[model samples]
Target chain A: MSGTAPEMGRRDGSFEREPARRVFASELRECRYQFKDGEDEKSPTFVLLPTGERSNRIFIVGTLTEKTRQGEQNIFYRGRVIDPTGTFFIMAGSYQPEAMQQLAKIETPAFVAVIGKPNLYQKPDGSYLASVRVEAITVVDKDTRDLWVLDTAAHTLDRVDALATSTSPDIVKAKEQYPSVDPAVYRKMAYDALAQIKM
Target chain B: MDYSEVTERISRKFSKSGKEIDRQKVEGKLRRLIDEFGVQPSEAERSVSNELAKEFNIPAAGSSGGTGAGAGGATEQKAIAQAQPGDWVTLEGKVVSLAAPASPAIAQSGIIADESGGIRFVVWAKSNALKMKEGAWYRIESAVVDEYKNIPNLKVHSGTTITEIEKTDPLIPEPSPIRDLRPGIGSVRAKVIQEWEVTHDRMLQSGLLGDETGTVKFVIWKEPGKEKLAVGTVYSVFYAQVDEYNERLSLNITTATIMQEEGDIVTATGGDVEIRGAIVHIAPGSGIIKRCPVPGCNRALSRQNYCPIHEIQPNFVYDLRIKGWLDDGEKTHNILLKRDVVEALTGINLDQAKEIAENNPLGMDEVFLQMRDKVLGRYVACKGREIENRLLVNTCERMHFESGEHAKLLNRAGGAP
Candidate 1:
């Protein structure tokens, strides 16, 4: 957790740590739009999730179903983390050597949790692929995955509620950007994700 | 009432006045000035008269300034306690304290005292007033008193004049024990127990200072000719401003005078507090994370993917931690579980996590996932020091839970409406 105490003196434009948002993989893949609020190159780019919320960093707990190690010198460790709703694609590279090394060594079909930034890449076929740039990852159990499922469901439902009732600038931007957003669809997704968890 | 007589009276005052006075337009202007603008009917008459004279090619009366009658009256001198809110008064008092301005717009703010009592005073940056040195007497004229939280505050505006005068009778601060210091100025003689690194440039020194009574955190702001304080040396800190943040007290020594005393003090340290609560929310950057490997720098690596000071590091050290919120049915407390505590709670050590990641093709994330599954939603008792809303947990244990309660909770969670 970030320090709750306010710093005595901090300069402007200093790096602010973004909280990792709890989101199900199914809702994460629906996010296709991304934008940066500030003109500074160092500013974080946010992926506007379909649920009326923008996510720069995300956290998810799921089962590691598949893995792939591609490239030689600048190696990339790619994996798929499956939750109750859908699968989240994650990639760690040379820049994050520790995460890459950890990704290369972990076993498949095991429960795992990941905290990373979301990136959207447009394919040549005019389709968008959403993936997570893995920052930290670790092995977890079924209980942890269940807890994550409940937490993510709550967060997704909150976004759905915001979409229906709130006219906040971010929600308004999301409404304007994604016109076909049906709050009912996400509400059901959250319920389904919750149902999959065993306690 | 008809304004024709008033209009004719105004017309007769100007030389070569015409018969072109529209009684309706004059009435409308008079009504708008009186009703819409809340101007006095008498003043509205003068304004309408001036406008009518100008329209008739006559020079406007009353020096062309309508509302100059109520400007620059003699300011009434009053004691600090006698001044009420919204009163304009000239106050002559000694500056008892100089507090750090909460905002850039406020150049200076602190307590000023006369014979009656002490009252808070603020000097606006736009006021262009002379700076009041702590303990020096100042005659503040035309200051507007405003109320904040039922206390009257003297607000120095552009019209307010601040003149530094000879020193008045000094208001001596009462010496108090370290633990007895509240949100005000107090004097204390304490020995430095621990010295922490200066994080910001404005901070000259910061550390734990303890007396025979109790220990409190002390911060000395960097000022001209201020020397660094040595650890274990007893100093008499006079007029140190006490500030409470996150329910903890700290001594702010901006305008305080520090003198090394000859006596030695046996310092008393605080004991650890124990809390039992359910871990409700787990914060980010928990589980297996990387930190700057530099010997002194242990900052957690964020989006920059490197330390701000050391820059891009080749080998970042792997660390294990669990930062989460604990709810005890009343309020939530931020609790930080270190590696040892996390390992004891989750049964997954840092070495085990690293090994599990090294062995699995899915990597270190598997460990984080496993740690999350075991740690989240578990009830535990933690013992630690409360620092800035966070419990630096040193020892922790899982509270025993009944299987029946778990099953009931699960059913309630599963049967969601």
Candidate 2:
């Protein structure tokens, strides 16, 4: 604190980059924690994804339910993917031409999967606005979309169980990051997603 | 043993021809000298005789000022800081630092000190000196304390006697803060903030360590079956070989070195650190360099073209490297990206780097330029050890997001960039 030297908190760079995540648009918007040191560090914006798991990266596979342009020049393309429970927004800029061109060919209401990074912004009211900066977007079959739902629901349930019961320090840390954690809505989402197959 | 005999002796001494002897005064003086003064009996005999000689008008036999002893006669204790120039002094302390012989005449040059302070000392080869060990206290007698450029040092020659003393260790300085660390501290302690695999003559775990004052890159020499230092642990490291690279100090952890995890023993954790900054400049030694093709000796072969192990006739392999400076609004860290990591960042494989070098007249300089175009003025997130000012890059990537992305976005877990 006396300008002694660099502090260790600023240089903890290796944490939370090990796995990408799968989350929902509503949960992304609801979550609010952004940890960064400076421009040189990839500050992991901590969030509780829809599957009730806490992570920094998220992977989504849903239906290409809607597509629209926000900017007047049409340089920015924003699309909505519908998973069983919630919508995941996929944004592709002019820089991501391959993903943009791929999205243009797909018709509305088709099953599509997207891998992207979560962009988090803290609102003035202390809530966070969340979106995904799409790295790759692909059209998949109905079966592929269903399989994703099953896998994602299982992951979300496993996380929910861990959060509700486990006292491991890492889970404790995740809980601290998102203080008012509620996993019941995601548990319900998981149950509702499974009912469509009705096995 | 007999008070009557002692009284008779004092009375006899007082019975000189011209002196008026007061028997009471003679016994009274002897009583105070023996009882009150706590003088040794043999020494008290001499004092009483002298006292009687002075009192009864006989001249004393010896001068009373106790200045008879000199160096080597009776041991003289002096702090290293108190030793004056041209004084034959006795120094009782431990060796703090020792320099191996640079020439034939000087056997060793080192630091010696006691609780007071320290001074440089030289042991001459012809002094037929005993091998002085570090961290051991010894009493050095009859040594000439000399001054050079106003700095004092003990110059020991053949006449000096060095005897190992029976006592606790002389206090050695604690591992200095990272910022205060300079060349010549034989050992130190710091938290292992970053640890990763590196090549010396073989594959080993090396990374940056630091205290509040500063940081240094340390390499643990690979021992086939030994445990390695874990990240996030603090250790008191001994005899790490010191070196200077590009004016910044570095250390090598050898097999004989001792490292104990002193988790709470140290004041600073050399806390969680990283360089979040934009590339401001590209350092030299970037681009392609020839590495030794020898299985374990992957050291960068110097331009004179020799590997320390394989010498003269050597096989070479191509490796890509990147060195640059990153300014994180506050501090600037020198970063090095080696081989595959460099390829991942620059998008130029080793072959491509070589081809680009050969095609251009500037050769390696052109390759440096291309890398500069990709990196300079751009933000980067580098994970690695920050020793001295250099960031030994383990995993690094462009920092385009205002907030951190999923770890998978940059590929692989990060280290000191």
Candidate 3:
């Protein structure tokens, strides 16, 4: 909307647009660093990338490998999206009604992009599990999916590159959170995803 | 919604501008804009509204957005293409890329894109409100915009609010071109011209690759003999890690790096080492150059012939340099011959160069031309390293290809260890 000089978007609205981060499905599930946003806030949880980066909002692209309606609300649209390396669990709620509708209309094995927040749950064994809170999901083309793969691969490599000397707080947290993650696996996932793309 | 439904929405928006336009006419305008002007339906709607407002002498609700640095209402959507530093902004974009911060104290950063373009934004670590999810459209508001390295950047601070909304049309960015290749995982098309033995301790295979843009040195670290880039073959290098060593960008063809041969590349797009070419072009400062007059700052005086630190005329000094191209029968390399190299090749020292400069009315121009004549047309094999795409010859000897010195020339390609 061209109106005046280039400036930050008008701050008139009460809502803010979140910046989405790209992460591989394999790395996302392994991430165990979950913390509250701003200490007192609840609802949206933060997951630290194994390489020490943190993000509440992440966008991922993959094939919608499976989907099902869970419980009474059918309200919970449970789905799994398979990337090059692993599959991500997506739970679409009433808040994501549009994404739910889109999910219902699209067939499985279709190229899909999902933008979601991280939701963490602790098991009885004390280990943590990370799944996605579907904020939005849409069927996309191969081109869009490949571009996503490229960006995600680049991001994953940045963390791997930084891991050698990263003693920063995020990296330290990541090391503590997912101590079992080889990081090599994530790098491989990124490369595999990129290889699938024609470019 | 169909075309008619979209047109009705356009008419309602226009009526708010206090302009009375027939609904049928507006629909006709939308149809023409879509069919003839090639405007998108949404864009045509906005165009029709603006046109009707202009016709009625009414102020357009959405005035043309200016591009200079300024502030605005946070709710206004600033397309990534229109975003600038200093704007209190709100907009929708897909998180396309993310970067690890140097310090966890600093906010995380990444590139956000829409159909307009992409931008880098930092979500303050302290904000902790949202670790933005990439690949989804968001409603970001109350964020401060700042310039990072001369480019406008968005900063999501404590007060910034992030709301994930329904996904919009996908925004797929163009892949990075060879010329735009920088340090990181870059995809490029290059030709392998030389390969070195694996390093003893690291087992890294180092070599050189060339593309039309320029030549780059590369190193690969993985299982030996799994991948071998043949000489003179062009290949698409993907996921290659680019790093800077000796202040030059080199690609690390590591375990993850992929290279598929396209064909035998005649371009000889390779590194600037072991160049065998003739001098076809000579730069202006090839002969009789001057150095800075300031003490302890002995930089060569630029074309302006002024010292950057002193901002004044530097004392003229005599130096001999042979600047020209070295064509390897396929590619031309910019080779610079320093004083010693010049003296060795042309049998002329700095004092002799000054004598020629003093006798000629054109001074350095006459000397530069004479130096070009002596070095031109002759092919020389030089062992050198490239600094910013220009070859700085450490050692050189004129080649005699037909004289059965093939082994000697090939040995030079190994470089002086």
Candidate 4:
């Protein structure tokens, strides 16, 4: 619902809607660092993107590979969405009842576009696992998926470009946090993601 | 109940055993068995938890509610950076900075950073927690991570504990480079490269600053006792607010303190870049177009002569521009050609384009069609500044093909061994 139209939406005076970032599943999986900007409890939780940006929400179009109803008392759905690069784990619970219902009804192997929050949880051993807390998931066409691939590739490469050129705070912080990740690697991933689309 | 909680609780069973286990993977395995294999939920949980315990060589918890590890449901002690939105984490960090409470319910709120990174923390007045002073170290236990504006902040409540500690050296954020400056208060030391004519009445001085990384345009507004910066002198500007305009980064130093420094900074010069590519596609709104006549609001008008902001303008100024895309094989760059570049590319100046639009039965679209036919798929080298993926083309010329290179390619294809 948040990403159906590209036009900017203002919810109210106090609540500013977080723009959903378009990133490849490959890049999204590597996102471990999470932060928030304001002090309000309702402020969105943003994940620090490796290429150099803070993403509160992510907009991705992928093929729904599998789905499973995970909960019993309060049912939630776990959906596996795969893009050109990798798989994005999606979890929709009672908190997002509509998304959960939508995920439950949708058949597998369908092209799906999702706009959701990036959620991360740390293991006791210190490694972090990332997934998307589904806000909205809609079945889409192959053309939409392809368009998203091209657009996401461009955005990913733009961030890769900013990693070196722009000294923006988020870029600087991303560089500091993810020092081992080479910017060229993301460039290659973007190219690889783009190659999946047939013009 | 969320299955994630069940999976996480099961995951805690292995935390003290020092065996690595993915919580989501456990949830996935459990879900697959129950949803796909049609096993009972209790059986699925038991089997999955047992499988993980056996794989890691730890004793299995008999039931889903049982805690296998000796830690026995204790909250995880974590670094400030590792804490997630919902987790109850015990963090040992110093009170780096404190701000005035936004509401009466909040007793204290500030940033707490360890060696990893910094996080904002808030102590609720209802919690009756001990007051924390800035620059002092405290061990905050059982604090919940609350998210706001996509950032994680610490919530100190009645359940949380705070203790003073003597820890040395938390990671202090360094003054970011000009390139690293986002839309926030930042400090930078750089040489004033060029000063521009003050365009606005409130603008005291505006110019370009350069350091080793890159150059940024800066504006010092007219304020009481504000000093003008001399060109070619290096100044250390502290707490300057960084803002963006038209995809380019600029600095506003109205409330900042400036001190001239001794070192001469070698500024990275030359913003012009030449990109050789084929004009892949011509975007809409190319060739002849009408713009709002209002100064500083030169937005293109709709087909009905309605400006988005100004609304229904009777008189509009004609402008010549080409919005297109250029693909240099690997990536496609958005290209914008203004009146000058459009004239050079299509041999149709603004006046000619206006005449064509006015006379043609097809109206303004005829000029667009002609321009598209002339430039689409044409191999050209455009020289300009690349800002936010758009190349503002200053100079444009058709790329010349080298005969020798073409001959070599032909030979390789026709006469190869």
Candidate 5:
């Protein structure tokens, strides 16, 4: 059954990680984590994963904390997880079958890494929501967290300088082609650029 | 946003550089550029960016958009013109007229005329009048261009290049003889034929004289230790100040100069006549007097009148009041008299008169009658300088009587003929 399980997972291939695409908490479109109640005796709480560059690429982070049942077949998990620089949303939908299964088995306070494309969700109140669709999952710790911040800062500055020097049309075109590019990335880039120059 | 927000944004943008840019300096430069070029804010911003980029090697942001190239071109031309300190310019013209010396530092303006133009050129007195031929061709060199009514004119200063060209033909048809004279200089001789004592402090004396041109009034000063000038005497006053006031030319004597009766200088043809009048109706309290009370008090005393301080009355007081006109004349002025002069004219001690007034109703009337004749129709020449429209004649030496030459000039000029 274990061999069949590995073969089935490989055949499905949805859980397979892409080697060329590097995932960091800073790069995640949305990140979230949930932990089980401290008094819970039987269930293991989910642990949070660090998201910035130097940290282990493992965490599912989001801003939403509540859980809701969708239809009768699927359960939705949502919460927020913050890296050193900022916070992002983590979400488990019906499409994230593995993440949903893991979420259901664990108690509250559980954490996991998430890999997915950034997506925008609109609420009925006319405000937009940001969350990451879960692709793969892992766990990380505090030492890894500190290095993520510094590495993220360096990478962000390079982007900022590039933006500042490029021709006006190029900037406009870059923004249009990469519609999902996080504006907060630019802000963080500017701040990091300023910090480096100050030093 | 509020001013603080805008300032914060600007500060953030400029703060990376180690040196701090004074916000006021930047604002002042902006305002000056606005005024100098008469440009709008956007245009001014672009110009400032360009100038800073070129001069300071600083990067300028957003310089592509502004008033188009033509308007900018014109503004640049004007700025270049203003920036240049010296430029060659020619003003070909005739010398039409000459103005009197403006001041010690400024050259007089000479009105010039030419086939193409007419303008005023400042000519510095370099070689006296020898270099400048009034009727001949005058070519000024290296004159600085200045603006008058938005039109360019030439100004000659100390460093100005100057040259005089020989004339093929005289440009000025009739040129008057040049004289080495100024407003405050030299001696003027005149004959004094009549005199009247105008006031106790000062006297007004006038006389006639005939030079190459004609005769005019020679108003002379009367001071202590100076010989009293007699009527029909010719006097040469050294270093007198000339002033044209109220359409009349008059001479003023300085304290350092001397006035003497020039007996040898005689008048040939008495020129025009001059007339002078005395001020009447002085304000009642506009003179000097001794206050009856102490310095700090407003009270007046009756018996043994004295200020409590030192148990003695101080001898000086100053107040302002108007006195009525005694002489009926075609024109009248408000006369000002000191209390001492009033007492002297009336021969009534003010303290005794105040006591008598308190005791008898007719005492004040008797004093008024005694002072009327002496105060009325008397010509009092005030010597003190004027304050606004009112003349404050402080010294008694300024009052003077009209001389016979003054009277004759007045009568001949159709006054009380």
Candidate 6:
């Protein structure tokens, strides 16, 4: 069998699936993508979205890529964390003081789990970057990594299917028609419905 | 759903597809497709699926292979050059010289040459002995690029690492020095030969002399030197500094430098003539003045005949002060009166003018009018230091009366002095 067979079995859940687990490496390389969280506070946050998110509240597992300096007193850390998909950066702020403290103690490649929003940061020089601010982190092993890859792959494929069918204006029209639909909910429903369509 | 199952599924799907797709490209395409389709997936569901597909490079069921390939290619082509911080690069160039070493510690950075091109670089006092063996090639690494005179140059900072390379090719030829060395240490020197004192405190004196490099301005000091040296006299200057100001380089002899009449006359060699055109603007208080209460105090008296300081009678003095235009047909300059020169030329005590102005409102106007003819359009030989646009001539001696015949003669001689 080709190396691609295992990837197919996991996508279809041909193998056993378990709760997502975190995988840590000596140096998890990742991009730092910035976003704002909370409506009022709108804190600048970074999210390390696992290369794939196929399950609800998908567990994003990686080690804190950046080191938090205890003496520096500043909240910015520069490091990369990795998962099965790819590597991404973790820029933790004061809101994530607990994560920061935990990160300071752990050595590079320590395992972690993050639950936060994902965002893209566009620079003036016309570059798009990806990053995450971890809401939580937990250690896990290879068994967990396998499960995450399967779940994330399924959801990602579903989104791609949804996008191929709908026109750009149809999405805009839906938003206008469903005035009461919360934007986040409407986006999810639209994508899921599109994903369900038969190719 | 377990993350391992998700990765396995993703891995299995891509493994079977026989085509590789980057997770990021898949995520972007999925997001755009969802937006285009008006399909709303729950945040959790959408995020989870997108993450899995993006991480595992799983193509959505409906995604056309052609479209995916095109998008992936476009994304890959857009990748920018990424460099980690603290990386170092090298810059090399030829040297461009400007001012000479006035003070031994002066560090001037000029041009350097490389096969690519020439760029400006500075060598410090510590690096002053960097053996710039004109034309030899040297390479400096980790030097950051900076702008000087709106031109980019390599700047060597503390973090900068430098390496010098020996000349493999022939030595680089040096450009000719801009000015000749005269009155420098161990060189023949001369003093002011003839001078014309202008109403303004400046004076211009010129004479014949010769050194290895030939005759040049020697003792052009402020307010004209106390005693002018006679012609045919040579002086020896122990130490003199050369400086470039306003693109003209000249020598400056300090008091510590030796100056004495040697009685030996040296013939002059014709050199490049230096000429400057200045604009003089006269304001309200610029004419012949009455010395107020003391020699230094320039305050005028009030109508009540009371001086600001003394409030009583004091001696008055007069001097030549100008309040008119000096036009050289090319530029117009407003000239002001130097108080001492005003006193010397007018023979009226400055203090007396203050006293008269105290009683008469038109007194200053009358005095300024009398000096206007002596100043306007008249040519004066000037030797001075320049600060910005204003020339502070140490001596301003009026050379020629303004007349058509004189103007004709000057024009005929190409305005030579």
Score every model by TM-score: 0.49, 0.39, 0.31, 0.40, 0.22, 0.25
lDDT of 4 by residue, B33-107 (tens): 877898865457557866886787654443322232332233577877687776667888877656668899899
Q: How far is candidate 4 from the true structure (C-alpha RMSD, Å)?
A: 22.7
Top TM-score prediction, candidate number: 1
lDDT of each: 0.72, 0.62, 0.63, 0.73, 0.39, 0.40
Lowest lDDT block of 10, candidate 5 chain B:
B72-81
Residue B403 error, candidate 2, Å: 11
- Candidate 1 TM-score, C-alpha based: 0.49
Off by over 4 Å in 3: A1-9, A12-16, A42-44, A125-127, B1-417
What order do you get sorting by lDDT, best first?
4, 1, 3, 2, 6, 5
* DockQ of all models, two decimals each: 0.04, 0.02, 0.01, 0.02, 0.00, 0.00
Output DockQ, candidate 6: 0.00
Interface C-alpha RMSD, model 3: 22.5
lDDT of 2 by residue, A1-199 (tens): 1011123222543221224454544556665555433465644455544333455445566788889866767677889887767777788887777567667766898777675667777669976677777755666555455545554555656666777788875577667776666777656655666555433
Ranking by TM-score: 1, 4, 2, 3, 6, 5
lDDT of 5 at B15: 48
lDDT of 6 by residue, A13-35 (tens): 33321122222221112223223
lDDT of 1 at A1: 18
Report model 4's chain A TM-score. Answer: 0.91
Interface RMSD of 2: 16.6
lDDT of 3 at A39: 54
Q: Model 5: how far is B252 from its true place, Å?
A: 5.4
Per-residue C-alpha lDDT of model 3 across residues B306-394, encoded as one tens digit per residue: 76665656465556776655544224566777788888876777888888777878877777656654554344677777655467786
Which structure is stronger by TM-score: 3 or 5? 3
Q: Higher-TM-score candidate among 2 and 4?
A: 4
Per-residue lDDT tens digits for candidate 2, residues B1-417, read 444555554454344334555656656766777788876543464566567666655644222322223323322468766776655577788776566565898898777767765666888776676778877888887576655444566877665677887778637445556666544334577787666546665556777777766667777565565467788788776544455554666765553235566454343535335666555445556778878777656777776568777885355777888876555422456677888778888788889888987788988777876775565545567886654445767788765422122222122112112
Mind giving the per-residue lDDT tens digits that candidate 3 earns over A42-112?
44466777767877777777889899987784576888988876888888767777567767777888887
The segments of candidate 5 whose C-alpha lies over 4 angstroms from its true place after superposition are: A1-199, B1-187, B191-241, B252-261, B264-282, B286-330, B333-417
State the TM-score, rounded to 2 decimals, of chain A in model 3: 0.82
